[model samples]
Target: MNRLFAATGFVPKKDIRGIILNRWGHAFVTPQPGFFFDTATRTAPRNTVMKGYGRISFGHAELEGFQHWGPAADQGRRAMTQALKNG
Candidate 1:
């Protein structure tokens, strides 16, 4: 399953900012619902509470493997930095 997803580009080819893999081998595109809500309540204005809040839905279970061993956090950070530098 994981191989299929990777072959089809269903999962992220690599990790990026704000993305993380869960224990179930699924990619969490955004923070969990509760955590997002809590953070929004504390730091975001009411109007913007839903601004950056969203869900992580995937079309393939194979890609879900990313939730377990996707790229490391620092790797994601470096990728973001490199993207910014190149752009």
Candidate 2:
């Protein structure tokens, strides 16, 4: 799926792996390394990497998680930032 399909209320496994396929027609069923949740908002059904989106995967409460679009992008950027800092 496109990054546009990711947002809050999205559980990484269900949202990112169910149907939305990549350009190569590949849907991932596995989580990346360091995939974890904040201890504060552990009140979700599954591994809730998205927390501020609607059923339509829009950023209704995106900033609530310090995330811009969704978990996919947010995590990607976070990792990039960490890598840059380390480099």
Candidate 3:
């Protein structure tokens, strides 16, 4: 499932200022920690306090399924930075 989602080229884009959150993501913090705080949640939303906050992890290193500090993650961060800067 992790590989399948990663292959879809999907990156959370709802973040207004790059804030990310996960209700219950077990995939995070281990085999796929990259998505720990962005997507791939293991539970449903229960708190309303986080409402209005941006949920996108635009250029997060591991959010894209790449291992932290990996070359691919670096490239993704760079790309997201550039995109944000250009706009």
Candidate 4:
């Protein structure tokens, strides 16, 4: 499966893991146990990580029970920043 995707020149080789291989030979990482409900708005609430629609993955410890996209993006950004800072 990975070989096939690599040969097709679909997704970059470095990202071909821990996700489902889709029909387009692309990696499809399932949402991290979250959901979305669109209010027809383009942007989600500030500090809320929104995947799509109303799906959210909250970031702050105070809002841990909520789902949001801000938290997810913020988390990734924080990790990258920390890694760079460390190096």
lDDT of 3 by residue, 1-87 (tens): 335565676454532346567665323323333323434554322122112134322343333445455844674666566566555
**Pairing residues by index, what is the TM-score of model 1?**
0.22
Candidate 4 residue spans exceeding 4 A from truth: 1-65
Ten consecutive residues with minimal summed lDDT in candidate 1? 56-65
| Poorly placed runs, candidate 3 (over 4 Å) | 1-69
Off by over 4 Å in 1: 1-22, 27-71
Instruction: Please write out the lDDT profile of model 2 over residues 22-68, one tens digit for every residue.
Output: 56333333433334444564544223533322332222223234333
TM-score top scorer: 2
**Candidate 1 residues 5-71, lDDT tens each?**
7666655545333555565443344434343233633642322332322331113212222333243
In candidate 2, which residue pairs clash? 1-21, 8-51, 8-52, 8-53
The C-alpha RMSD of each candidate to the native structure, in angstroms, is 17.4, 18.2, 21.2, 14.3
Clashes per candidate, residues 3 or more apart or on different chains:
5, 4, 2, 15
Candidate achieving higher lDDT, 3 or 4: 4
Off by over 4 Å in 2: 1-27, 30-69
Q: Which candidate would rank higher by lDDT, 1 or 2?
A: 2
Candidate 2 vs candidate 3: the TM-score winner is 2
Among all windows of 10 consecutive residues in model 4, the one with the lowest summed lDDT is 50-59
